[model samples]
Target: MICDQLNDGYDLVEPQAPAMLESLRAFGYNIQTAIADLIDNSISAGAKNVWLLFYWDGSESYVSIMDDGKGMTEEELVNAMRLGSRNPLDEREPNDLGRFGLGLKTASFSQCRRLTVCTKTVNQNSVTRRWDLDYVSQTREWRLLRSAALNSEDRLSCLDKVQSGTVVLWEGMDRLVGETKTDDSKTHKRFLEIIEDVENHLAMVFHRFLGRKNNLQIWINDRLVKPWDPFLTNEKATQWLPEENLYFREDKVVIQPYVLPHHSKVDQLTYEQAAGANGWNAQQGFYVYRNQRMLVAGDWLGLGLQRDEHCKLARIQVDLPNSMDSDWSIDVKKSRARPPAFLREDFKRIAKLTRGRATDIYRYRGKVIARKSSASYLFTWLKKVKHGKVFYVINPDHPLVKEALNIPIEYREVIKALLRLIEETVPVQQIWLDSAESLDKQSQPFEGEPSREMIEVMSQVYKALIKSGLSIIEARKRLTTMEPFQYFEELVNRLGE
Candidate 1:
C-alpha cells in the first residue's frame, strides 16, 4: 500500500514518440554494421542461410535481408519489433546473440525510415509488421503498421518461398542513397561499393561461422561470402601458440595466440590476401569472439600496446561466452571491447610474449639461430638508446666493421671519420616510414643480389680472420655462423685454404 501510494505521487512523464524514435538514429550504425546486427538475430534464431538484396530504384531503392531461420509468429514478432523488448540482464541461450534487444530498432533506424518484418512459422499463417517513422512522427504516437507499405509487398515476397523463415525489408533509405536516380551511373557505382564493404565486413565478423560446413552461409546479391581467416591457419609457416584459459566468476576466457607467417614465407597471392581489409599492421592484436561470433577484430583492447610494424604478425584470439559481455564492456555496436580490470594484466602479459615472437620473425629471427646452435644472427645496425631517446648506430662488433677498424694507424683516423659521418646521416625517418607502409615489400639484405657480391665481402672478412692466426677451416667455420653467409653455406665452405 505504501509503495502504491508512492508510485501514485509520480507524474506520467512518458517520452515523446517522435523524439524517442528519432534519437535511435544516432546509435552509430553504418550500413555494414546495421546489416550485421540483423544477421545476429538470424543466427540466434537458428538460421542456416541468410540472403541480402540491395535493390536500386532511384528514391525507391530498398534493401532486404531474408533468412531461413525458425520464424516468429504474430505475438512474438510484435514483441521483438518493440524497442528494448528483452531486458539485457536476462540470461540468453548459449548460441543466441540477443543482448540489448535494441539491435533491430537502433540498427534499422540508423539507415532507413521504414522497417518491415514478414515472417512465417509452422502451423501458423504468414504475419507482417512494419514500423514507419514518418507515420509515428506525424501522429506523435507509437503506431507500428499492420504490414509493409503498398507497392513494397514484392520485397517481402522472399518470405513466401520458405516454410518457416523471416524477411526484413528496409525501405526509405534516405541515409544511404538520398535522391539517387536509377540511371545515375555514379550512384550505381557507389551503391555497388557499399555492397562490397558490407560483404567484406560480414566475411570477417562471421568468418568463424562461415568456415564451418554446416554452420551458416551468407550471400550478398547471390554471391557467396568467403571467410577471411586472420591467422592464416593453412600456411605452413604460421605459428600456433598454446592456448590459455582464464576463469572469471565461473566464465572461461580462452586465449589463443598466433604469429602469422612472414610475407616471404607464403606465395604472393596468399601474402597479399592475408594483409586483410586494413593491411597487416592494423590487423594485429586480439580478435575477441563471443559465442563463436567475432565482436572486435584486430584491436589491443586499450591494453596500452602500439601496433608497430614488427608486431604486425602477432594476432591473438580471445573466445568468451556471451555471459561475459558486460564484463568486457561490449558496446551496443559490438565493435569495441575493454577487458575487465582483473583480466587486463593477464592480457598485457600475453600480448608482450606474442609481440616478442613476432618481432623476432620481423627482424632476423635470431631465436631460430640460437635454437640451432651457439651461433647468433648478427644485425648490421644496432638500435641504441641515449638519455631515453632512440638513435641508430652501426654495429662496431660486426665482422666488416672490425675489419675496417683493424686497418693501419695512418688511415684509421680517416676511416673513423668517414664511418661517423655515414652513421650520423643514416636516414632513420625515411626508412621507418618506408618500412611502416611497405614492410612486407621491403627486401632483405642481398635478397636478390648475386652470390659473388656477398662472396667478395665474405672473402675480406675470411682473410682478416686468417691473418689473426686462425686456420682456413676455423675462418670458414666462423663465416658459416655469420649472417648473409649462413644463408650461403656452400659458398662459405668453398673458400680456399
Candidate 2:
C-alpha cells in the first residue's frame, strides 16, 4: 500500500480471508490452466522433472504435483501461501514464469478447497503448510496451517525420495469432483478424462520445455507427456517463412511464421496429429509465448483477420519476454495477451504476408506452378475485375469448355448461354458461408469417394486434347497439369489408358 500524507486518516481495513479466497478462485482458471500455473512455479524453481498424481476416491479425489526443484523452507512456504505474496512489478530472475506471486495460492484454490504444500531443501528438515478454505471460512481469519491435513502426510512421500523438492497437494476438489460415491465407475471415467485434459493442455502449453532432449519431464500417473508442437518442424513439407524480429522499448520480440503442409503432402496419421486438439481450422493463428511458455495459442490477436480455410495453414510464433507483460496486458491467468500499438502494426503486416502465402499454398497444391513446369495452375472460376464490382466466370479456354464450344456452330450459342447462366448463378455467397462455417464439410473435387468419376472426367479432357491436334503423350501431359487431375498422379498416369 502506498503511503499518503494523511496516513493516520486511512481506515485499518483488511479483506476477510474466506471471501478473498473465494474471489481468487474466479481468476478464470480451468483445471488445466490452473495446473499449468503451478507448473510455471516448478519450472521457475529449476525443476527438471515434475510428477503429477491423481487419486480417485469419488468425492475424496485429489491432485498432487511434485517437482524435483529447489524446495522452499518454512518461512518461504508460509509467505508463498499468502495471497498476492509478491509484487508483479518486482524484477524477477531471467527465466521466472511467475508474476503477482499468486499462482501457488490462487491456482490451488481454483481447483480444490484444501491446498497443502509440503516442501524440503537439501540438508534441511521438511516443512508443511495447509490452507483449508473450510477452516478459514469457519475461523474468519487468515489462518495458515503449519501442518498438512490429517492422514495426508503420505501423499508428500515423493518429497522424501528427492533431496530437495516441492509437492503441492490439492484436496477437496469441489470444482473438479463433487459429492459422489466412492465406487462409481461412470464418475471414475470422468476423472480419467479430466486427467487426460490436464495431460494434453500441459503438453501444449509447455511444449517448448518438453520438446528438448533432456529439458523438462512431466508425468501424469507415471505416463510421460510428450510435446505437441503446433508447427510440425520435422516435416520437410512445412514451409518455414523468414523470421522477423521486433523490439518494444528495447525488449526483443521474435516472430516466426510457419505454413504447415497441405493434407496431400503428409500421411493421414501425421496430418490428423498435426491438426492439434482443436483441429486444423481452430488451431490456426498467432501462437504467443512469454519466456518460452505459451500464453495464447491460435489467436489472430485482433488483427481484423478472420480464420479462413485458405489461411488455416498460417501459424505465426511470437515470443516475448516477461518484461513486456504490462505492454501486452498479460493476465494473471497467462491465457490471454494483446499486442501493443507499435507491435500490432507490425503484426498486421506479417499476418497479411503469411496469410497470403498460406492462401497460395492452399489453393495451388503447395507447388509453385511456374517453377514446377511450363503449365500454369488452373483456376476453374477466374476472378475478373472490369468495373468497380468483382465477379467470377468459368475459364472458357479450359479443355472441357473448349470441347463443348467445338460442338456444332448452330448449338454454340446455347452452350454459351448455358455457361453464362451457370457462371452468373455461381452461389458465391453460399460457398463462402459453407467454407466459413464448416470447412471440413466442404468437399474438394471428388473428395471422399473413389476416383472413378475423376478418371472419367480426365478421359474426356484427354480426348479433347487429342482432338486438338495433340499426340497421346502431349494430351496425357496436359491432363497431368490440369486442376484436380494434378493431385491424382496415378490417375493422371492412366489418363490415356
Question: Which tens-of-lDDT digit does each residue in 308-401 have in candidate 1?
Answer: 9999999999999989889888888877788999999888878887887699785566444553653465666876655534567888877778
lDDT per residue for candidate 2 within 120-184, as digits (tens), equals 88889889999999999999999999888889999888888888989999999998779978888
State each model's CA lDDT, in order: 0.86, 0.86
RMSD of 2: 12.9
Best by TM-score: 1
- In the predicted model 1, the residue pairs found to clash are none
TM-score of each: 0.77, 0.76
Single out the weakest 10-residue window by summed lDDT for candidate 1: 366-375
lDDT for model 1: 0.86
Question: How well does model 2 score by local distance difference test?
Answer: 0.86
